[model samples]
Target: MTVTAESALAGVQRIIATYAQNIDAGNTDVVADLFTEDGVAEIEGQDTFEGRETIRKVYGQFSPQTPQLHLVGNTVLTSEPGEEVTATSNLVFFARGEEGWGIQLVGTYEDTAVLVDGEWKFRRRVTKFL
Candidate 1:
């Protein structure tokens, strides 16, 4: 199937939204599944995670009880019909602290998404905290 500009944006957006939901829900396994076999994730202040297994292992450190909400916005996508798509989005992370739920992290996600076997998966994602 050809990946048109519209399809690429929509598919990548879906992946972004799904990622936020899964991470907030502490379903890191599901989040890991959203990436390609050799996907890489680089988060600020953390070691870069390469491959799904490593990604899952690292993300497993996050406890479900912590309760985090990842708010993603302002996504921009650039792509060709049959090539990888590059996307960027702003992120606001709200987490439950000792006092209450509040914004704890602000960042931007730079991602490379590829269509693999008719599915859009993350090839590489970099999170830059601001």
Candidate 2:
């Protein structure tokens, strides 16, 4: 109802939108930019990646490799307060390559969003393989 709450919600929306941008455009920088200077991305069966640099490399690996499309919906949980926000949702991703435009992966985005310079960004996230 307050400005902070609205900003926080907007930030959450941005984070989720960025996920779509990252996969569709292969722009990992946008993905990492969703986070702060010190951000973490934890994927299953992989060690946690600390900071944006590691995130860049990881995105590079994914971008060049997979023809991907990430469709995210159904926010199951969310937290607020402009400086801190978190959202959990089901992300249905589609991919194309050898298979050509079929369902690729179904997963969840556990996002930790933070506000910096009055703009919200993701401080960390766990891309849970489900």
Candidate 3:
């Protein structure tokens, strides 16, 4: 299949969306697979996780007691088609707890993604809380 710039951009967007969906649904188990074998995840104020196994384990720790939702938007991508792309997006985290539903966090995601075996996967994803 030919990869046009538009198609590559769309694929990268899908990867970002999928990550948010999986996290909000507490499906961290599959989240690691969205990344490269040696991909890195760095969440501000937390330990940096590298490699799929380590990333998986770190995400496993986020078993939220209440249902959560992640809203990701305003993605800006840089880089040529079929090459590693860097993207930045805003994040708004919501959750329902004893206090009722509310916004829990506001952040931004800075990501570097690459096409691997015909699929886009994250090479590095950084979360900065604000």
Candidate 4:
């Protein structure tokens, strides 16, 4: 299957949307599945997690007990050579608190994605606080 620029962009956008949905649902296992085996998630002011196990652990920290919401927007995707793609997006997080819901953090994610077995998976995601 030939992956065109438009198709690649759409695929990446779907990945991002699914990522947010899984995270919000606290589906850590499914969230980890979105990454490559050696995928890395680097968060500003936090320890970087590498590998699916570590990624699962990071997501586990924010469990269903801690109801949260993830809002992603302003996504820009670029198709690279050799089935590689890069994307950047704005992220806003909200958590349930005594005052109902409140913003927890705002950040941007710089993502490196690659096609693995005909599927796009995250290779690396560097998250920076705004």
Top candidate on lDDT is 1
Expressed as tens digits, the lDDT of each residue in 1-130 for candidate 2 is 3446666666687678876876588887787777788999898777788888888787777774666778887764366464677778788878787757888678888888876777777688888877
Task: Give the clash total for candidate 2.
Answer: 0
Query: What TM-score should be assigned to candidate 1?
Result: 0.92
- Model 2's lDDT to the true fold? 0.76
lDDT (10s digit) by residue, model 3, range 29-58: 779999999999999998689999999998
**Candidate 4 residue lDDT tens string, 22-113:** 98998899889889999999988988999989999888996767788989999887446347889899999999988899998999989888
How do all the candidates rank in terms of TM-score, highest first? 1, 3, 4, 2
The TM-score measured for candidate 4 stands at: 0.91
Question: Local distance difference test, per candidate?
Answer: 0.89, 0.76, 0.88, 0.86
Model 4 RMSD vs true structure: 1.6
Extract clashing residue pairs from model 1.
Answer: none
- Over 4 Å off, model 3: 1-3
Cα displacement (Å) at residue 34, model 3: 0.3
* Candidate 2 ranges with C-alpha deviation above 4 Å: 1-4
